[model samples]
Every structure is written in structure tokens, then in C-alpha cells.
Target chain A: MTAPNGMRTMLGRVRGLGSAKSGFAHWWAQRMTALALVPLVLWFVISIISLVGADHAAVSAWAGQPVCGALLIALVIAVFHHAQLGLSVVIEDYVHEEAPKIVALVLVRGLAGLLGLIGVVSVLKLMVGS
Target chain B: MDARKRPLSPHLQIYRWQITNSLSILHRMTGVALSVGTLLLLYWLAAAATGPAAFATAQAVIGSWIGRLLLFGWSIALFYHLCNGLRHLAWDAGYGFSLPSVTKSGMAVLGATAVLTLAAWIAGLVI
Candidate 1:
């Protein structure tokens, strides 16, 4: 195989580098989230449409149903997870500074966690009639 | 990283406008858009967890014309991104590599995105 340049070769760069498998995984997750989101998004659209004429309590109560709560929880969780993964790629692409990249990634992960908690707790509150 | 100079393929300017190009670029565009939109989502989530006033304030922004416009844009971006992301998934699975097939599916993604976005907005108006 021909070497790419001064210090690197094409095969060396492509061979089991940090970018292949995880590259596919990142791409896969984005698409997976996109696929997972189809029905979830449709359900959310329907829910939002229903909420148009609803009062606050009505909105909360409607969301408080078991099925609805379950879906909403899934929606938020999927959303946050998808967001984190997407942003991670973006950060990895654009953020050249090492420390900031790690920081931003951690921040995204933390934000995802917070959003997940909010989603789960909200669903629980809706579930127990609280 | 390969820092060596090599013969390059024709760039964007060299090729005629194609659906695949449009859709592929749109994916990146929507990614950036959704990055901003996520902040809005965060606002929504925080408001939902907060008191009624806070939630209403958030709702009020969404109820406004600017908010609606942004939401509308976000909606389209969402659907476009979703469709193209699926297209990407198919590619990753070792499918749709042919140029003709790529263009065909890319058009489908664009068409689906527009249809869904318009339908959603219409549905919103009706309800």
C-alpha cells in the first residue's frame, strides 16, 4: 500500500482508527433516533394538536394518562439521547481544543441526564395521580 | 491524518444541482438548526417543570408569531433531518450507493419532509 504523506499512510489512517466503528455507530444512532422518532413524533404531534384547545389542567391530565405518559417519557428520553449523540459528533468535528471538547461532551451528557430525569419524574407524577 | 496532496474529485460547483446534494447539505443545515432548537426544547422542559407562570411564559413565546415561525421552521427542519437521516441509515447499511438511487431517495426525503411539515401546520391550524 502507498503511504499517504510525510508521516501518515492512507491505510494507516483508515485502519482501525478512532473514526471507523464509532463513526458508523454515531451515524447509526442518528439514524436510529430518526427512525425511533417517527412514530413518537407523530404521537407528539397528535398530543400537541390535542393540547391546542386544552386548559392547563386538562393538558396535564391528558398527559397524565398511562399510555400518554409513557409515550411522552419516551419522547423526551429519545430526544435528549439523540441530541447528545448528535451534538457529540458536532463537537468532535468543530471543537478542536481538547479540553473544551471534553467539557462540552460532558456538559451534553449531564444535560441529557437532567432532561432524562425531568422526563421520568414528569411521567411518574402523571402516573401516580400526583 | 493524511496531510498529503492528492487528486481530488469534482467539488460541488462542478456538479449540477441534484436532490442528493440538496438533501445531504440539508441534513447538516438541519443539524445546526436543531442544535439551536434544542435550547428551545430545554426551555420547554424547564418551564414544564417550573410553575404555571413560567410555563405560560414559555407558551406565550410559542404562541407568538415569531415563535410560531421559528417553530414552523424547526418543524420542517425536523422532518427533513429525520428523512435524510433515514436515507443516511440506509446508506450505512450498504444500500443506495448508486447515483440514480441516491438521487431518487433524496427527492423522496425532501418531498416527505415538505408534505409532513405542511400537514402538521394545517393540523395545528385546524385544532
Candidate 2:
């Protein structure tokens, strides 16, 4: 059933309040990434702890493991994505201007994506023993 | 618009201290700190992928006193963010909304963060 004459649906009302008219996706994605990071980050912290005082060869060998590379790649992606989402919230809250806000958001996303790529590539290089 | 002379919401300084309030602010603060710390992670990855000299240079910086201090702070921030993020996830799941529970969880998050951070540092020092 449709809403009566000019009455907005609940979703429609929410969509109206957001600047881009698409707030839910960002909110959901942030939560999803946060959930993914929980286990991945725990693994990362434990692995990093284990690698302490380890030499370059030892650390590289550890990273070269198939499981290690895959998980690290996943962690890098989730982490950067989550970081971008969280930073954008802070920026939007404090920036107070449209132009700079957009610029800051773009920069945050671009830099995060770039650094995430670099992280995955580095892991792959180690995995391939190159 | 009447925005030029509009009233504003009372800011932090005017408010009494509360657990939820401090944790809310700290959640954002830790997030921003961790974003900057990501650069250090990137550097380590890049250094590792490069030759021995590059890795050594990276290690030297990371092993320095200032670097250690930064690392400690970053670790604390990371743990705090992790704990608080989980608390937020619990909130998202429709639990911990009551005032008592919120206060308890907020304190628990902070307590967990401090303990975990100290444990991590001890492990680092030992290994």
C-alpha cells in the first residue's frame, strides 16, 4: 500500500534530512567494517606482538604465510575503509562548510584507499618472496 | 536566514563531567589519532617490502625513544578505540541503553583499554 496524498514514508523523511540524501549506507558500511575489524585487528595485534624482536627474515617469513597475507589484506581494506568513515564523521561535524567538507571527505577517501592499496601490495610482495 | 545571530547548543565546558560524555569524546579522539598512526603502519609495510637498509632505517626510527613513546600512545589509542567500538556495537545491537549499564560499560571499556595497553607494552618490552 502507498502513502496517502503527499505523505512521505519513513525512509523518505530520513533521506530528506541527510545532505547527500544517502546516510544509511555510510552508517551501515561503517558498522560492517567495524565488525570485520574486530577479529582482524585482534589477529594483527597478536601477530605483531609475536614478531617483536624478530629479524627481517623472520618477520618476512611470517608475512609470507598464505593465511597471514590474506588476513592482512582483509585487515588493511577494512581498517582503511573504517578509518575513512570515522574521519568523515568528524570532518562533517566540525568543518561547517560545504566546499571544504567535500574536499576533506575526498582527500580522506583517496588517501585511505591509496594507503590500503600500498599495504596489500607490500603484503603480496612479501608473500611472493620478491 | 536568522543564522547570523542564532543561539548555539551549550558546549562541553558548560556541562558537568560524566562517564558517557568523556567516553564519547574519547572515541572520536582515538579515531583521529589512529588515522594518523596508520601512516606509521604504512611506513613499516613499505620498509619491509624494501631492502635491508630500508627496513633497518624504519626499525631505527621505531626503536628510538620518541618513536617508542608514540608507539605506546598509538597502542593505547588503538585498544581504547577497539574496546569502545565494541561497546558501540553492543549499543547498535539494542543493548546497554540504560544509564547504569551505559556507565558500567563505559568504565569497563576504559579499564579494558588500560589493562590491554599495559599488557601490550609489557609484551613488547619482554620480546
Candidate 3:
């Protein structure tokens, strides 16, 4: 059977390629994280601004609050997850070499995870130590 | 196949600079900047968790001139990324696809980002 253009069959046009299987999950997760980050980041900016010129004790106290700590942990997780997804796309776009692309993707994920862990642990410590 | 000899589509250099194009690229640029800026947030949190002395040192560094500059840049980047990300979400939802809507939304995002960054800084300084 010929396609409308008579160049190839309809199945030939679509065969061997339907879905990558993981692209949608990455995209949906990116959007979900962005949605979560909107409120989290706005609250964080306002809180941090209000704490400007505040002493270490004051800042610690603010961070130690149950609500603040929870939101902060949420923000950190969302930010890093979003960043990892974003940087991975950037690397994939610009880094053509297969090996370097994989390396960069791994490095970005590792760094994002490490920093995110530090943020969560730090917030937890402030809550416990305060 | 010799990749160098392959026919290539029009590249960025072929297009005239425009608001929509600029804003689209700026979104990606700000995203990357904000990614690096996350380190500053992590440092602050780590210091706060450490002790008063460490917190003081962190404050000192952040309070310095260069620190303020970096903070200013990060704040701008954050606001830009946030605003544009919203615009992206709207696009994803299948609204504002027309050329005029796209351009108008781009301008609105820029306006919002500027207002937010400045307002935050002013509030930070005055309050």
C-alpha cells in the first residue's frame, strides 16, 4: 500500500518508532515540579526577605518552625528535582557525544541529589537542634 | 554519511531577533543560572544548621558587596524563571498559542519578573 504521497507506506512512516517510553514521564515530572515550586518558592522568597538583617538566632528560629521546615524541605526537593530534569535536557541538547552526554547527565543528577540531601538534613537539624 | 555535507535547516543566525525568540532562550538561560544558584541556598541552610559561628560566617560572606551582586543576579534569574515557567505551563495547557498572545505573554512575564525582583529587594532592604 502506498501512502498519500506515494513515497512510503503509512506503516513504513511510523514503524520502528512509536514511543521512547520515558520522555513523557520526564516531561510530566518537570511540569509537576514546576507547579509545586511556584508556591514553595514564592513563600520562601517572602520569608527570606522578611528575615533580612535578622540574626543567626532569628533565622534559625524561623527555619526551625514546623511549617517552615516542612515547606523548606519541599522547596529544596522540588528545586533540585526540577534542576536535574532541566540540566539533563540542556546537556542532551548541546553535548552530542554519547559518553560525555551520559557523564554530564550523571554528574548533574548526583550533584542535585547531594545538594538536595544537604538541604533536607540541614532543615531537619535546625528543627531538632533548636 | 558525511555529517558536515548534510543539508541543514535554518539556524538561529538566520532568524531576526525578536521578543518571542529572546524570551524563549532567556527561559532556558535563567533555568541554568538558577540551578547553580541553588548552591547558595544550600550553603545558607548548612550554615544555619551548623552553629551560630558558622551562621555568622555565612552571613558575612553573603553580606559582602560581591555577595550582594550575586544575590541580585540570582533573584532576577529566579523571578524570570518563575514567571516564564508559568507562561510555559499555560502553553502546555494549550492556551496562548497565537503569535500575538505569545508576544504579549512574553512581555507580561518580563514585566512581572522585573516588578517582583525589585519589590523583593526593596522590601528586603527597607523591612
Off by over 4 Å in 1: A1-28, B1-4, B8-18, B49-51
Worst lDDT run of 10 residues, candidate 1 chain B, spans B42-51
The estimated TM-scores of all candidates read: 0.79, 0.89, 0.90
Query: Can you write out model 2's per-residue Cα lDDT over A4-109, one digit (the tens) per residue?
Result: 6458768775656767657888999999999999999889989988888777888788888999989989999998999999999999999998999999999999
Show where candidate 3 strays beyond 4 Å: A1-17, B1-7
List clashing residue pairs in candidate 2: none
Docking class of 3: medium
Return the candidate ranking by lDDT, descending: 3, 2, 1
- iRMSD for every model: 2.5, 0.9, 0.6
Q: Evaluated with lDDT, which candidate comes out highest?
A: 3
TM-score of decoy 3: 0.90
Scored on chain A only, each candidate's TM-score is: 0.79, 0.83, 0.86
> Candidate 3 chain A — worst ten consecutive residues by lDDT sum?
A13-22
Give the TM-score ranking, best first: 3, 2, 1
Docking class of 1: acceptable
Clashes of 3: 0
Write down the worst ten-residue block by lDDT for model 2 chain A.
A13-22
